[model samples]
Target: MPRPTSRWIAERASVGTSTVRRPDRTTWIVLGRAGADVAVVFLDAEDVELGRRTVGADSWATWAAEIEAGEAVRWVWNDTPRWYAELLAAGTRLARCHDLRLCHAILRDSALVRADADLRVHTDWDATPHADPPAAAPTLFELGAAPDAATGLPEFLDDAVREFARQRTAIDGSTDPGRLRLLTAAESAGALVAVELRAAGLPWDPQAHDRILRGVLGPRPAAGGTPMKLEDAGRRVRAALGDPSANLDSQPKLLRSLHRAGVLVESTSRWELAQYRHPVIEPLLEYKKLSRLLSANGWAWLDEWVHDGRFRPVYVPGGVVTGRWASSGGGALQLPRQLRGAVHADPGWCLVIADVAQLEPRVLAAMSGDRALADAARGKDLYAGIVDTGAVATRAEAKIAMLGAMYGATTGDSGRLVPRLRRTFPRAMALVDDAAREGENGGVVSTWLGRSCPAPSAGWHAAQSLASAVEASGGDETRARRWARDRGRFTRNFVVQGTAAEWALAWMADLRGRLAALDAVPDSDAAPRSGAVFSTRPHLAFFLHDEVVVHAPRERAEAAALAVREAAASAARLLFGDFPIDFPLDLRIAESAQDD
Candidate 1:
C-alpha cells in the first residue's frame, strides 16, 4: 500500500520508516531527534475513537526533557477533532490524511467509495438565470430536493472562478483579503463543517450555528429558558424587516454566546460583528492591529494568531487557483513560524512548526519546463535569482514586477516595473503575458495538470469585440475607445490568473494525497478510548492566504511539521515529477496565540 499523507509526514520528519509505508517501519525504531516521548498512533478523522497512545500523563515538556535524556517513542498523531465540519461538497477527504482502515469503514456507506458513483454535481452558482435582464425582484422559487447535478460542468464553467482567484492573489499580494465573499463562503462552509463534526461526536461550536440562525432570525426577547415559538420569532422578523425604528431583538443566547466565544461582537442594533471588523465594531480593535502590521511590515501580524495554545486553521477547497482555494478567513497561508515565541509549551509543553518553502513558484517553473528559469532558482530564491540572471537593480523589485506581470497587475509600480522585467527576461515574461492575453480574450487557460480556467460569457465576448473594433479604428478619442480599455484590462489578466488558480488546486490535491500516507500525529493531549489510546486527529483549525494551522501535541507536532513539508515536496513532485527548481520551507514552534 502506498502510505497515506500522515504516515508519510511522520516517516520523512524522523529518519525512520512508517508502518503505513514500509514494513520496515513496523520494526522497532532506532532512537532519533523526536525521541521516545512521542510516537506514531492512529485515530478516526475526529480523533474520538481509540487506536494507540505513546506517552503517559506527563506534560509535553516532561517528555521533551526525557527525549533529551535519550529514548525513542512512537505514539499516534493526535490533535483536536474537526467534528463540526459538514457543509462542504467535496468534504474533508480532500484536505486530510485518513487511515484506509478507518476510511474504508467510514466511506463504506458514502457515495465516494461506491464504484458506480459519479463525482460531478451542479449547482446554479453559474447558471445564467439572470441573463435575460436584471429583474427588480428576481424570482424566488423553492429549490427543494436538488436534481442530479449537471455533468460536464466544464462546458458551463466560466471565467468567474479563475478571475476571482487572480483578483484575490493580486489583492492578497497588495493588501489583506479582508471580509470578502470568500470569508462568507468559508464561514458558511465552516458552519456546515461544524455540523458534520458534531455528528462525528466531537465538540461542535453550537455558538457558531446559533449565530447564523440569529442573523437570519431576528433577536429574541428577555424571557425564561422556555423555547420561544417560531411564530413568535417570525412575528419579530416581520416587525424588524418592516419597521424602520423598531430595534431587532436578537437571540440573546446566540448573540451573547458568540460574543463570549469571541466569534462575534455587537456593533449596533442593526449589525453583529464579523472577524474582519469594521469601524464602530468590537472586532475593529483587533482588525486595526492586524491591518497596521500588514500595511507596515507585511506578514508581521501573523504573530497575533499564534496565541490560544494551538494553531487551529480552516482549509478551503477551490479556495485559490482555477480549482484553487484561498485562506484569509483562517490565516492558513500566512504563518509566523520564525516567531515560535507565539506558540507555547503550557507549563511543560513545547511547540514545533515547520513548512516547505518555494512551493507554488517552484511548481510553476517545474511545470512549465523552463530549465533556464528552474536552473536560476536551483539553489536560491526564484525571484531573487531571476533578478540576478537578467533583471536590473534589486531582486525584490524584479520578483514583484514578475509576479505582477503574470497576474495582470497593471497601472501601478508593479505595472511600471513589469515592462522592464519583460525586456530583460523575454521567455518568462512571454509565457505569463500569453496567459494573461488569453484571459483578456475570454479564452480558457490550464494548469500543468489538466485543470482548466473557465471561459467568458456571450455578453463578455460582445463587449470585447466592440472594444477591439474601437481600438482598431485608431481613434483614442471615441467613447467606444474608452469603453474598450476596460475590456482590454479584464481580458489581459484573465487567462494568467485563471491558469495560476488551476496550478494551486492541483498542488493542494497532490499534497493532501501524499501527506495522507504519513500519519503525521501531534504531541498533544488524548481523550480516552476502548482499551486503546486513540489519539486525536491533527485537525486543521484556521487558514489565511497560504498558511494552514494544525492543532497538535508535542508528540505529534514535529510529525505534523514533517507532514506539512513532505506534502509540499510531494506536491512539487506530483506536478513536475523532477525539475531543476527547488522549493524550500521555513519553520517555527510556539505555545500560544499571542506568540509575540
Candidate 2:
C-alpha cells in the first residue's frame, strides 16, 4: 500500500496535527490511489444524497457507483485484504496530511507515492480488441481457413507440404536467411513452423511485429521457461468461467493453461485476444518472424512504397480512445518522427495530401458557448489561434499547453500557461476541466457519445460530493476550490475532445465505405499494387492520429484529395447536423507525414 503524503491525507487520516487547520466544509480532494481507493473517495463523501441523484438519477447509476466504489478500496495481499488499517492504527495527526492531488510536478519522484507519471503510461486506454476480421472473413483468404494454410503453407504448394509433413523425419522448420528452412521431429507431433514473406497489403505483419507478436509467441530464449503445471493452471480457467467442469476439454484447459503460464494476455475483449495461440499459434509467430527478418530495416519497404506511389494504408475507426483512427497495420504510428520527402506527382502528377488544422479544439470551442474561443479558432490552427488571441506567447507553447490542458495536464510549462487559457476560453475549457476534476475526485467522466470512464472509489465519491457541496454552500471554500482549478478546467475541454473523436470516426467509416466500392482485383499480386492507385479506386494508404496519406494513380490524385476533405466535412455535418457551426478544415497537400 502507498503512504499518503503528510499534506494530502484528510484531517482524520493524517499522521501529525502540527500546523493543523480544518478544511472548508466543502473541499476538492484529488484521487490517484490504486484499486479501492476510488471507492473510498466516493463513499466517504460529505454529502451522499446529493451525489447520489446526479443527472440521469437511475438507481442503476447509484448502485453501480456504490459497487465500483467498494471494489476500488479492495486490496489483496497474498490473497488477503489489507491497506489503510496501519494508518488508522497509527492515529496520525491532520498536519501529517498532504494535498490529495498527485501532480507529476511534485509527487512524481517522491518516495511517498507508489509510482510516477512518467512510468505510468496511458495504460488505462485499454488495449482493446482487434477490429480486423479473422483470416476466414475475407473471401480471397478462403483457402487459408482450410487445412492448406493451417500450418502456414502457401496456397500453390499446399498439397506438397501436406505430403511432406505426413512422411518426414521432422515436420518442424525454422525461418532464417541462412538455414532458414529445416525439417525436424518434435516431441508430441509433426508440424511445419516456418516463415513466409507475405505481400505488402496483408494486415498481420508490417509493423508492431515485436509488440504484437511478442504478446503471441513470446520471447524465444535459448531455453524456454519451466513448463507450467497443466492441471493446476486448468483449475483457474474453470473457476473463472464459473463452471467447475467447463475446462475439461483440452482446448479450454489449454487456454486457461496458457493464460496462467503468461502466454496470453487475459482481457475481456475476445477480438483483442485473436493473437492468442497454443497449438494453433505457430502461423502468426511465423508471420511475425518473417516480417521482422525480411524487412529487418522495416521502413525500407515502407519507403519503397512511398517512392513508387503504391502504399495505401487502412484506417481503423475509433482506433484510439480519444476518437482517432490507427493504420490497420505497418509502422503507421511509428512513422520515423520526421517528415517524408514531398511526393512530387510521380514525375507527372503532384501529390495532393491535405490535413485539417486545429480540429479537436475548434470542435470544442463551437460546442461550448465560448464566442471568444470560437472567434480565435476561426479558420486557423486552434493552438496558434489561441496564441494569436494571447492565450500564450507562441504557437509552440500554445501547442504544448493546450494539449496538456485538454488531457488534464497540470505540470511543466503547461501548468503555468493553462490558467491563462482557462480565463480566455472558459466556455470551451469548462467542459474538459470539469471532467478531469471529476476524474481526480474519483468521479466518472464521459464522451459526448456516451463512452464513459468508470467512477473510481469511496474516497473519490466523497471528494466530488464535497466539491459539489462547496458549490451549494453559497460561494464557500469547497465550491470555490473546486471551480477554481478542476470543474472549470474539465468542462471546458471535454466537449471538444470527445466530439472531435466522434467526427474522426465518421470520417474513417466514410472513407472505408468509399474504398470498398472500387473495382475488384483480378489477381492477388495486382491487388496489393493496385491498392496504391486511387484513379479506378482511391484507397486510404496511411492514417495517423489526425492525418491521412493516400497513394493514388497519376490521374486521380486530385479527386482522392477532394474525397478525403469532403469526407471530413461530411463527418462534421453528420455528427452536428442540427448545429449551426461550420466545422472547417485546413487542407494541406503533402506527400508524407514528413510533408507540411
| True lDDT of residue 480, candidate 2 | 44
Q: Which has the greatest lDDT?
A: 2
Off by over 4 Å in 2: 1-319, 323-329, 339-351, 457-496, 512-528, 531-535, 578-596
Number of the predicted model whose TM-score against the real structure is largest: 1
Score candidate 2 by lDDT.
0.40
Candidate 2 vs. true structure, TM-score? 0.42
Deviating ranges (above 4 Å) for candidate 1: 1-315, 319-321, 326-360, 410-416, 465-541, 592-596
Q: Residue 145 lDDT in model 2?
A: 28
Cα lDDT, all candidates: 0.38, 0.40
